[model samples]
Target: MTRNRVLRQSKLLCAKGVFECEDLTTLNHGVFMSVKRKMSDEIKSVWSRNGANSYKEARDVVHRVEWEDYQHWLDLQWPKK
Candidate 1:
């Protein structure tokens, strides 16, 4: 599927509180779940900065964020060398 489609699907999955999916797995982790959990603090900060009114809205904002922007955080969290 296309990148936007995958993002949309991931947002939907997060709304339903279902994080894991076979096709969406990366490094054996659910994309949304990994982002949400690993970067909870940062996500919360972004959510507040964006004035997201609800958890779902925050999640949508998170889904739309650029993954590359968090590369440093990801590297620190996973440290895959």
Candidate 2:
């Protein structure tokens, strides 16, 4: 898959709260420690929001932040060769 497609799918997966480093490895077309780190951070952030006002609201916030982070990562041209 193309880089853009991989980035987009990664963002979607993050938004959906499905963070699996192994999966990201495949999406990245190879092992990418930076991407793995970002994904790990996103998951940790989301998991940290477990005691918010409502689970749904917390999930929404996590998804929004994850998408934003993904966009930032894309803008940075991550997984630099």
TM-score of each: 0.29, 0.20
| C-alpha lDDT values of all predictions | 0.44, 0.37
Top lDDT model: 1
Candidate with top TM-score is 1
- Model 1 lDDT per residue over 1-81, tens place: 575575557658788887633443353233345455665654652221122111233345534444454454345574234
lDDT of 2: 0.37
- Which pairs of residues clash in candidate 1, taking residues 3 or more apart in a chain or in different chains? none
Clashing pairs in 2: none
lDDT of 2 by residue, 1-81 (tens): 564465557757888886533333332322233333434534333321211111123234533334334445444434323
Q: Return model 1's CA RMSD, one decimal.
A: 9.6
Local error of candidate 2 at residue 77 (angstroms): 3.8
